[model samples]
Every structure is written in C-alpha cells, then in structure tokens.
Target: MKWSRAVHHVEELARRCDTPSPVPMLPVTGLWVFGDLLGEPRDLDWAHVAVIVDLPVDDVPWLDIPRGGQHWAQAVRLREPLSCLWRSAAGPVWNHRIVRPALVWDSTDGVRESTLSALRDGLGHSVRLDAPTPSALQTQLDAELAVSLRSLRRQHRSYDDQRWRPGKLTPHADSLWRATDGYLDLLDAVNAPQ
Candidate 1:
C-alpha cells in the first residue's frame, strides 16, 4: 500500500472507533487526532492513534513522534487501536493489511498482536500498505544511517572550527559538540553491525 492509502485507512479506523477525525499535520507527512495526545490513554474515550508515514527509505525522518516514548510499545498495546508499525526504513511492518484476525507485522509467528475488537469493528474500513522486501528495507536503513553520520561529522567540524575563533563564543557550543560526538560514536557502532 502507498502512504496515501495507509493514511486513509488509519483515518477511517479512527472515525469508526468513535475517535475524532484525523487532521493531517502535513499534506504528505502524517496525520494526528485527539487520541494522539500524550496524556491518558482513555481521555475523551480515545486511544492514541498514530498513523506514521511510510516514505522512501532515504527520505524517512530521523525523529518519528510515534516511536519516540520510552513506553511506546506498551502504549501501543494499551491503546488498542490498529497500529501501522513502521520498521527501520519507514517500511510498513504491521496493520497495513487486515488479512489476519490479530494484525501482526515484521515477521509471521514472531508475536501475537491485535486490537480489542474484531476487524468488523472498523466499520468496513480496511486497506493494505505494500511493504518492501527485507533486503530493500536494509539498504534503505543503511543509506539513511550513512547520510546521518556524514551530517553529524559536518556539524562537529563546524562547531570545532567556530568555537575557538578570534572572537568570543558561547560555552554551549562545547557541550553541543560533546553530545553530538557521543551520539555519532554510538551510531558508528550501530552502523558497524558487529
């Protein structure tokens, strides 16, 4: 399924669940609703529904709102709405289709996951997001990570070259580069894969 279809299905699901209609944050970015608020899950009788965008592997954003919180997985299960789980490369990993009773993604037989109600509860709303092959997904992830690493390196260089210039400078730049360097090192480890 394309990103447009994914957004459509998720929007329909939200309305059918008696939740507020989704408001698109951007024309092609993603959609959000009252349920997506970070507070209590049952507020407004809403379940936090997150319709994450599935873009080309290299175009995926580094920061994804839906996947950010510490208790994100728990939130997904507790919220009980259908989730379009995006894997590493903005690939549609789950709930992109309604083929099984309990919507599962990433791998078959890996885990059991579902919503509290049946697919019929969606009020006839359904769709599928065409997902990429595993190798294709991995290539996308690698490309994004490589680009991110290079960008971070450039930032480090800018900070180093500017911080001690002939004029006065703020101390924040020191801490900024320190943090960036640490994160860059961590990404290096992740990119190495072994």
Candidate 2:
C-alpha cells in the first residue's frame, strides 16, 4: 500500500476506535526501520499494534489487548474500561516487510514516565511522549515539539543535509501539539478569567 493509503487506514481505524483525532497520521520513525522490522519474531501481518491513552494518573485504566491473532477491526472489550475509545491499523508492508504504526496522547509526568518505560521494555528503546501540562512544562514541551517538527519537515522536503541526520521524530508529535491546544481549550471551557 502507498504511504498515504496506509496513513489514511490508520487514521480511520483510530477514529473508529473512538480515540480523538489529534493530528494527521505520519510515518513512525526513530528506530532503524530494518532492525525493527526483522527483530520481531511474529509474522509482520499479525504483529499487534498497541495504543496507549493517557487519563488522569489516579483515574488511569488498566486494560490489555488479548493475545493471539486479534485484529483491531474486531470489536473487543477494553480490559480497563474507559468512556473514550479508539482504533488503529498495522504499519504498511514494503516488499513483504512489515512497518509499525503507533498513536499517543499527551499525559501527566507520572503517566508519561511509566508509559515510556513500558514501551521501552517492550520495544527495546526509549520512547518519548509529549506530556502537556497547564504549568511551565507545557511551554517547554511545546517549544521542543515545534523545533522537532520544523527540523523533520525540512528533512522530508530536502536532501540538502545528507549529513544532517534528523533526530528521531515521534508519530505523536501532531497529536501532542493538539492535546496541548486542548489543554488551553479546557482552560477556556472552565471559564478561568484571563
């Protein structure tokens, strides 16, 4: 499938799952695509796509995607029941090779660190998620994400920097940015006087 098609598929799947759409789907990056593709023992087609949603730390849900070949398209009960829902699709395959797709949301510090550690244990690498806070951290994360996005756009648009190795950009950049925006919206919703 074309990259665009794959992105659309993932986006639609995510929507169907009732997960809020925060950003346009982008290619999952960072790891050496080849190593990640080959390292997993399972059939690429059957590789499970995991989705992590961030709720208030105290209110976080505990759910597990069932083992065995269960596609996200199938209706499955969330282990940790939540009011919100979401769906996602597998990454694209190229020349019979599997690519992985991921979705993330802005979380609190406790949630972010715990989730990052879990992902790292499972995927064998450190993963960063944007944890947008209403406090000072939000400003810092927003600036960092913006810089990363700008650099990524440049690399995607030009090969001018054969030497300019782009830093690993997360799939959730846009979503995190949106979540930050949502935080601001929440402030307005609560009618906090400026």
> Could you tell me every candidate's TM-score relative to the true structure?
0.32, 0.21
Tens-digit lDDT track of model 1 for 11-82: 454333232223232112232222222222222322333343444432322322222321433332323343
lDDT of 2: 0.30
Query: lDDT score of model 1?
Result: 0.36
Q: For residues 1-194, write the lDDT of model 2, one tens digit per residue.
A: 23333223333333344432232231111111222312323223322234432222111111211122124223433222112222112211111111232232222221233322333344422332233334543443343344334434443444433335666344234334433443444334334442
Best by TM-score: 1
Top candidate (lDDT): 1
Q: In model 1, how large is the Cα lDDT of residue 53?
A: 41
Least well predicted 10-residue stretch by lDDT in candidate 1? 95-104
Show model 1 residue runs off by greater than 4 Å: 1-61, 64-128, 165-194
> Which pairs clash in the backbone of model 2?
13-87, 17-85, 17-86, 17-87, 18-85, 19-85, 19-86, 63-80
